[model samples]
Target: MLKKAIGGSLAAMLLAGMVLGTDALSYVTTACGNVREAVKSEITPEFELDRIRNEIDKLMPEIRQHMTVVAEQSVDVKDLQREIAKKDTKLASQRDAILALRADLSSSKDSFTYRHVSYSRGEVEADLANRFESFRNGEEALARDRQILAAQKQTLRANQKKLDSMLGRKQELAVHVSQLEARLKTIQASEAVNAIEVDDTKLSRVEGMIKDLNHALDVRESILETEGNVLGRIPVEEDSVDLHADVVSEVDQHFGLTADENVAEAAQSDSL
Candidate 1:
């Protein structure tokens, strides 16, 4: 009975040890799986960080090259702007110079003067004096035309008086014709007719004189009508004045230099 009890207790102790061993084996297996999962999760993040670092390292040279190109383009743009500014300044200056020349030409054209009349009659120290005398002579001639016109009017008046006399004589001749008709009715004698013929010859001579006087009066009236128009018939010295003005204009156009206000203002605006 003691040996059987000892064997039963040994069997119980062996079963307990077998159960503890199984429990320990399951715990070790579960802990090992948890440790493996943790290690996998930790190593995954490290691998991702290393991949990103390598990619960045590979792209560094290309990024630096692109940045360098950008820097160089910026410098080129600055230089181009400076050159454009310089060209614009030079063009403005040239335009201002051209404007100044135009202004000077305008000023010179305004300033020029030309002499209209000049005279030197045999070097009598009378350039202006001779011209003045010529002007005076023209005035004198105009005055003379007035005087001659007055004289011609007087002659016209005299001719008109003679025409009046001729008109009276014509009326008298009509009266004599009526008287002869009456005499023809009253008396018819050859000797009396010869006496009438002599009287007729005298009347005919008076009629001829009247015709001449009327013609003379007409000529005198025509002379008086033409006297006022004589001034219009005088010639003008157009070539001299035109030549002088053209010469002065050409000289001013070629050699003058004067600036305008608008050009100066433009230059100032460009500088600003």
Candidate 2:
């Protein structure tokens, strides 16, 4: 109902715009274009394919009608051709009879005999004149019939060609529709395969939390080693000895003094 109302409103606006001015009409056209695009967005490929199939189905009845018409026309053309052939044979016989009578009259005969009946020259001439007139009229009628047959044959050929073209186009459209449906299915399948549900925000938070935990653990380990002073520095014997305390001991050893405290006093007394 809402969609219908919106459509009605759009149509009313378009009519009003068209009645107003070209600029308003242009605006209405743009609005309709936007609506058209919106409608197109909602229409799926499957729906369009179904519509195409329905349209193709509709054409079947019309094509069948055309086929029927062409078939009837073909029958009619064949009948006409047979009729023309029979007339042509009859006309040929009539023409030969006329030519024979003319040939007999040209010989200056006073009378003529035909089928064991003798007729005077006047009777023969009158009979020949009537026969020739009849033949002429028949030839004219046959000529007209031949023309009609030719035209009918041409019409039948055209109708047959049109029918063939329609059938061919129908087949092509069916194949094209099938191809489109197959391609649409392949694309849908690919999209379904490629679509993965993953939350980027959650994944990023997890990575950040792991990094922060590692940093905190490293800082705590460093603090513990510094406070305990256990294996904090390299173990060496040189670090254990005090350099200031060793200086007097090194001097006493070099001088070979037995009493380090009395050496200086004894040297002073000896000097005195």
Candidate 3:
């Protein structure tokens, strides 16, 4: 809205106040007041717009960072899902293979029933070695798959946590943006220019707050390499009992073979 110019009527009204009739002076007073109102109306929107711009600028970087994570997480979740599917298929295949091997081993041990030649000891031993070796290999492979799945799940969980945290922060920042927008919509500017000066001070304070918030967000460094590792299983250490030590001690105690005693006994025998 165009602010009506308050030309010289305000000064004229004050100077002519003592001589002018009450009705004419009242008209001049009202005109000056309308012009002030119009100017105030114009300034208010600009003030609010400036404030909103400052606030939005403060929040945009963090909001954009979270948005980036949201997109990345979408891709990560899909990849994890694919990996789980592949693992499940491989696990099932290995398990089926183990079952088949077990059946073959068991059936090989059976006596002759219907045109079946029973396996001899050598054949049975060979079959056992084959079946057991396959079973061990399959079990080890399955265990590795389980470990990989566990690590993947751990990674997924970490990513999910970060996603949730970022989403929450985004929501909070969005609310702040909306509030500033609403404030702009309803603002009323003061007629005094000093009021604008005070607001400019407030703008400075708001800028400082934005700086503090930005610093806080900047300092929030994330933990690196969230994925876990599958460590190879180590054998447990224990104290080992040595039977040879006991046997050697017992033999030494029983023999009592002193060199001086043996020499004296041999001398006595030589004399005899």
Candidate 4:
């Protein structure tokens, strides 16, 4: 279908160009190239590979048929060889018999004997002439057959080589296709790997929230410590004041201690 479309497009372009005049011919090459590129672009690698594989498969039957023909030809060549060998043996015997008959005739023999049957010189001569004629014809026929056999063998060798070449090419194509498939798989896998993505936006927001909460907690703890330190201190007066003597005497009287008794005891002790 694509081939037909391309062909149609090319025809239309050619027709249009013809209508436009010789000046349009300059653009034909460029237009054809563009069309070819467009066709190539539409053909995917996988589809092309499949097409190649199918073509390879389609060749198999023809190859097998050729193989069958070659095999049959091989058998025919062998059979012809055997036939030629038999003919060669028969010709050798006939040649020896002809030579023997000529020798007999050369001796001026008036009669010849064959299996106890007798023949005059004339009869032997006639038989020799006929045998010679038959031998010549047989030799010619054998030569022709030999030529045909040689040609057939040559053709078979060439064909066998062709088959071998085809088989080798098919193997190479199969291996190449496998390699292409594996490479394509690797590329697709890489693309899949490349396609993977991680969205860290929400994760980053959550992390920010956690950090803010930590900071707030730390600030609150710092504020509490500061307030406790400020409020837990003992209030003290900076100025030093002398205690009132009356207050001291009343404090001493409350504890039942007399300052005059203590002073009298201390004076008596000092005099002793």
Residue 86 displacement (Å), model 4: 1.8
Q: What lDDT is obtained when candidate 1 is compared to the true structure?
A: 0.59
TM-score of each: 0.24, 0.59, 0.34, 0.59
Candidate 2: which stretches are off by over 4 Å? 1-33, 195-272
Measured with C-alpha atoms, the lDDT of residue 238 in candidate 4 is 45
Can you write out model 3's per-residue Cα lDDT over 29-85, one digit (the tens) per residue? 788899999987878555766776677567668757766765676666567667657
Q: Tens-digit lDDT track for model 1 on 139-186?
A: 555556556555655655565565556556556655665565556555
Give residue 78's error in model 4 in angstroms: 2.2
Error of 3 at 93 (Å): 8.1
lDDT top scorer: 4
Quick one: ranking by TM-score, best first?
A: 4, 2, 3, 1
Clash list (residue pairs), candidate 3: none
Q: State the C-alpha lDDT per candidate.
A: 0.59, 0.88, 0.65, 0.90
Stretches of candidate 4 above 4 Å error? 1-42, 202-272
Please identify model 3 stretches exceeding 4 Å from their true place.
Answer: 1-124, 189-272
lDDT of 4 by residue, 1-272 (tens): 99999999999878977787776766777788999999999998889889989998999999999899999999999999999999999999999989989999998779989889999999989999999999999999899999999999999999999999989998998999899999988998998999988679988999999999999999999998779769975435345556797687887788776888768877999999
